[model samples]
Target: MHPLGTVLRSRYKIIHPLGSGGFGETYLAEDLDIPTTPKPKCVVKHLKPQNQNEVLLKIAKGLFNREAEILYRLDKIHNQVPELFAHFEENGEFYLVQEFIDGHDLSKEIIAGQPWGEAEVKKLLRDVLEVLVVIHQQSIIHRDIKPHNIMRRRQDGKIVLIDFGAVKEIKCLETNTQGQVTSSILIGTNGYMPNEQANGKPKLSSDVYAVGMLGIQALTGIPPQNLPEDPVTGEIIWRDQTNVSDRFAEVLTNMVRSHFSQRYQTAAEALQALTQSPPTPKSDRWRSLSNRKVIATGGAVLLGSIMSLYVVSRYFAKSPTPPNPQAVTPQPPIVTPKPPSTIKKFSQLPCDSDQQLSSPPPATGKPTWETDVYKYYGQINQKTKEANGRGLMAFKQNNFQYYGDFKKNKRSGCGRLSYPAKSNIDYYLGQFENDEPQGLGYLKLRNGNEYRGKFAKNKCQGEGVYIYADKTERDGIWREDKLEGSDNFSCKGSSASSMPTISFLSPKPF
Candidate 1:
């Protein structure tokens, strides 16, 4: 390994070795100068060139790609993930630049014999849940959530999750609506792995289960790897800890349960309980969301159906049955009906305070619209004889629409947007990356309120516009779904800033 200082990416002056793993070695690097404020430092994870197994190499490359994807998704939301600095390949090798945290991975503490303190466990997990709030909101799942990936800083005593090398993202089933691909990274350290991941049903709750396992180990002074196991009976040796608090033991037991349905579901639910005065994590909502059984379509459409593997596939694989358009026989009416001067097919609907629009008309055609693959609006013809090179999956659900990809059979690819799409409704149609909106898209509201702008995983990230159907509108730069600045609105005004925001409400449908 390179000694104290080895320059990398030309700009990063390597300071010293931070850590090393089976895959690669990490280095502390300092940016030369940018003339900003304090000196900038980052981390460089460089793959080891010595490993020669081709199959393993392919797996490593896949993991590297997964890591990059995980970091990209994390950067889009409010998680504790480190920012990506750069990713490049050179000299038959690959490298990734990332934010360097001045902390130790919790693995270090675990190895050094971390004491089982209930408060300490709660504090660490509380922060992790806060981070999960943002992560789950974006539909991004860090399949490999373990102590080693969590960087606990010494300076501020805060946690910054690092090493996404083992992460697996949850694609919002759409482009490949079939759950064809389940990631094989198989993250987590043995005992910490939930049955879903081990038995292959992992989702957002998989990470929650892992975290809960970590908490159990921390609270009871039992190392997960070495936790007692009744081999003959196939039971965990946590009865003593259960004696401490039936509630805590019950939570831990479920967390490590072999069946996904038996484990904790959402981080939100567990966090809510863990953060409570006595740690009473709820199971209902978490279970509901977990049992959703999200799958990947070659399209990004989410057909929210929960069932066993056989049933789910049978339901999803059911081909579109073309309706007989010629079933209606013409009937003669005794009296001739005169057509009205104008056809008023749609009626007005309620709108927001300063908005106006019509609700979508009663159902006609199919209750659900399935596009072969959604491309840019007006870009891909829904009814195209020619299967263009491009492929995406999309479908409508109730008043909203959501999408993602076909990961072999698991949700993969990218861009799964779930936004309302009513006739005159103003809803968010966000451009997605790895399922959640990540680029530019649009939002339409029920009152004919429309906003089109840049989005970073569903939230407004850059310049956007809010327009009304009656010729009123507002356009401006957005930070987190909210607009920034003052400009000309019909009667209302906006606050202006460097980005120069503008906005106006509209009136139409009504």
Candidate 2:
């Protein structure tokens, strides 16, 4: 209808865009002014009407305003959820600006699929229980604990719960949401929702049930529906579920029990059981940003969120370029017990001295994301001429090197980063102020792709360009790390997806 890239309510300058679900659009924006801010990019999710019905938009707008009222109260107590940014009505459209997560959704991870071995499910549930404890302590019910609403921040691989506090999330996780329309139309998804929630009563145990089901899903690659379920009883069908332990199954059984009384009555109880002194599998992914404090401020407006988010210092925005993991193509269904590989370390690199420049990665076959599974585990110095002129911070887990940057313990710089190996590719090197990749730097990827530019907080925010291995080049402004501004005539085609040349205000909570 309106031009494609229309700027909403004034303050939010959309960098590029994230996905748009039943909720409204999400953007990665920069706060106009604020240095050393957490979540420099913000996600704008304008409230969407529940139904396509005409009058519903009007009612939805009213309910949308109530969200801010709710947040303001919660903010007073340091709620970890998103802060209410600018909420406004312009041209009959209502909008909201909030925090942005630089990570993948738990649902996407589940759908894409991974195995949950040993105490993996227990650990995941325990992490959730802790969040719920905080939420319950705050007197809030995150009725929607489904995968889609739960995000895994790539920074430290921690789960950052989003989209709670809404009547919709409340309705979905706790009450009979789908195929039922009493006070509210069915708000939750099918399958994972508990039976009580499906019938109408939304309670704490209902969340426990869904979370239990999430455990089964995590352990088994199948979705809840695909898992066995009693047709008459509507109970989870767990008989033929292989690789699941009796004790673990018992844990889920008590959790997802049909009746609320049969389920874990409270988050504390659930947390207590899950927290049994069991040794966490070293390879299981548990890194997270939950511990990081996020300080939000509009001169006293953004105080609800913690002062920082847990994340290794590095840029996180990825190019929209489709993932081509064909190099690591393996047999379908990656189940089966495979001992995870260890992250390679620069400390383990040959010639750990300062005289000779560390050698560059062999320039023959381009290294696939798989070839460098342990790449993130080590400090990669592309500057092989002498001592550490430039390098990336990497860790190891799940057979790859997770990467980023490390100077002290702060995520102080930027580069092409990846999850698990949890590493980053340093494209530029130089001075840093406020953590943005300020000063001069050069990034040379193992794939022969490279970029040398002036960075701001890691993004090519000021001005920069890249010369690809195939000879293509891009020039523009970067928001988080993706390009946002217009590219030159020739660069437009190849640089179409990643908005690296973007510009916006830095992220400020609230």
Candidate 3:
């Protein structure tokens, strides 16, 4: 337990211990530097590495620093995310200071065995999804998304996402000479975590799955683990237990699909679907048009036009003297009304070729899969090769799908690599060589952050412009993944001219 009234760095004085976890302890503290009438309360997290081994300690320190940098980046732009005050190492232990939110976590409000109303559920989903959109856009995923991690702001009743301690970096696991797999640390709540996440391979969609579980728990008043799942499909069977509209059920179903490919690709997409109006049936639209009073009015006009035509013919035949050409008045041409064009139904709309509505085969088929390699080769007057052509490739093991030109079974020429349901750098579209990003290309991380410019060996190198999640741009030369110069990057909309720079610390030591 952290000692009460303990001051660190002669600035923040610990008021009380909030909680403690396996890796860290949290405390409510007051910032003494601000001599205002009411001292600002902040959260101080003490991160102590569990292992004394140097290698494990180094990894833990690197992860801790990386998380702090991520929080700093997000807090600068987003209001829902907690703001970082300061982070430092004291007595070989790391401590992070952040803005304390004065609100209760959702766990207190969301009680087990008590179902939430439809309107309340909808509001909850929207609020959380909006926050997630920002978190994901910043290329960060709140790995541990649960009722306890969400706080409802007392001032505005807005949902705030907290606790990014479990945030995981995008890295592939390794194997020893014996071909045995060495797993990465799995970091997610058990019931809320999807299969992929439980296996230590969480994607952006994994967060969506967790959110869906929350929704289900709210609606059914049952925990996710206790909810019954279909034996064959593995989908949670909660419709019978709850009374939600079919449309919302569909959205939730897609969100918590067993396969990541079938889930909403992003929080933005999920929010759009959740808020979208229900589609009106094509038959109902046609029925309404047919029942309209316009048809009766059209019939009366047609009868009137016929009678006038007869009267004009009779008068002309009975006339003693021929009417002068100039004296004959020209009647306005009778125009027939055209029925409305067939209402195009939603089902008739063009299908998204990339979207998989159902469970796709575990393996997407052959490696040399190209939809039209011959056409591409013919356009260039080159013969197509089995191992080389322009097409799409799916690497199931790494959860990556590549679409572009391939040479000798490698990603060559131009191509795009995407993680179908994950965030961070979601995809890279640019020049490729030997199955890696090379030369110039554009990279979009899952959190809406972007980088355009030169690349080498699958990393940002040379001259490039990096756009942060807050729409701030940094134009500089990059080596590996860090900016070259010591000059601080300027952030837009911020009073400070220079942003804090974090050194590039490698998670895996070479």
Best by lDDT: 3
Q: Candidate 3 on 327-437: residue-level lDDT in tens? A: 444343468996432221110111111122112233343432334211122112135343455555554334555566655545666566665453355666656666666
lDDT of each: 0.52, 0.50, 0.67
Alpha-carbon deviation at 236 in model 3, angstroms: 1.3
lDDT of 2 by residue, 431-458 (tens): 3433343544444454566554444544
| The 10-residue segment with the lowest total lDDT in model 1 | 346-355
Candidate 3 has an lDDT of: 0.67
Model 1: residues with Cα > 4 Å off, grouped in runs = 2-4, 33-39, 48-69, 107-115, 167-186, 195-201, 232-235, 241-243, 276-510
Q: Predicted candidate 2: what Cα RMSD to the true structure?
A: 23.1
Best by TM-score: 3
Worst 10 residues of 3 by lDDT: 344-353
TM-score of each: 0.46, 0.50, 0.56
Q: List ranges where model 3 is wrong by over 4 Å.
A: 167-185, 291-510
- Which candidate would rank higher by lDDT, 1 or 2? 1
